[model samples]
Target: MSTLVAERQLVADACRVLAARGLADGFLGHVSLRVDDERLLVRCRGPQERGLRWTTPEDVHLVTLDGEPGDDGELGEWAPPNELPLHAEVLRTRPEVSAVVHAHPPAVVTADLAGLAVRPVVGAFDMPGTKLAAGGVPVYPRGVLVRDRRLAAEMVAAMGNRPVVLLRGHGLTSAGASVPEAVLHALSVDRLARLELAVVSAGGTLVDLPAEDMAELPDLGAGFNHATAWRHELANLP
Candidate 1:
């Protein structure tokens, strides 16, 4: 298959996976796969129903690394999300990131709104490398438009090497070496976010990872169960 065809297929699969999982409520979230220099394939934003599982290649717009829409210009029927810049910046800064997924999962959103510091706990999938970027996930205060060029630059600077970042009052940004890995990162955060909220709700003292556990967890690495998870989510799709 051509690189463009492969990219389109990857992005379509990503959207179906995310939407089925309820991570992306209708048109609420976004997903993209790297194409090549200065471009990526993103699902065009608009008119999607909740749990949409099939997005055509036409639905995936080839966008610039700067998040500019491609030569086809804007899709007459759809547009890129206001957050396109966030995805663009992530790919630019983290060359290892082949795919990016962002979603407003309830648990994560709750923690963000509650002003809780959601840190990684010692677990099979909770690795320090997944959480801390070269500069760390800087919280861009909510006000900037999702596509604001300045915000895109800040996102790149902030997400340096991390697999994931949290946008205050917005959502989580997860990236990976492949489309599947990015989706897995999103699930990992959603699971962790639920635990964080539970910890806070119960007023139970939450424990941070000790040095030994931190070292061990990375090796165990909660391998992403994309196929199983995707199947489960799709079955439950509304």
Candidate 2:
């Protein structure tokens, strides 16, 4: 397969993994892979498609940074997510970002609703979670659907240089240099949210890992163990 074809498959697999991992609800979430500085491959809702859990390469579509479909006109009757601006604006602003994921994981949404923030209380047991805490995951503080350029720009401003941004009571948006990296970040955020809720339910006060202790941890950077995590998630697909 060509590079575009391969990237399309990656986006499709990411959609499946997102739904299987409970980070996505039916056709609610969307994943996109930057094809170039000007365009990206994204999952669009097909006329007959029911959910992202079973998304295939055909479900993926190519669109410009401005959310216009490519010349191939392959989208047909399918329509990109209303949040296309979410992906478009981020890719346009962040040169290092090549993949973006937007999903509504229940744990994350609930954590935001309860005013619980994800922190580094679990040590190194969860590398992504630990990294997220150290790097600082910002919350957008808004619960509305990002449907317009203005809303997306607001989210982009809130996200700043962070890899992940939590949309209060709505969902999350994660960006990375590759599809797996973006997916992993989304998964990490959900896990961290779930961990936070578990601690609170047990009546335990969250004590973030000391800054000194966090400073001692190694920097694994983005896309850490992406291949392994992607393979594990794909293996679990039915």
lDDT of each: 0.68, 0.87
For 21-136, candidate 1 gives per-residue lDDT tens digits of 66776567778888786878888765663333666566777777665665564555667777887888787777788888988777777776787655665355545333442123
Which model scores highest in lDDT?
Answer: 2
Give a tens-digit lDDT track for model 2, residues 1-238.
2347888888999999999999996779999998878888999988898898989888899888777876466578878889999999999889999999999999999998898887778777776678676778899998999998899999999999999999998999999988888998899889988999999999999888887877777756544567777788889987
* TM-score of candidate 1 relative to the true fold: 0.78
10 residues in a row with least lDDT, candidate 2: 219-228
Q: Point out where model 1 deviates above 4 Å.
A: 1-3, 46-57, 66-76, 125-138, 218-238
For candidate 1, what's the RMSD? 4.0
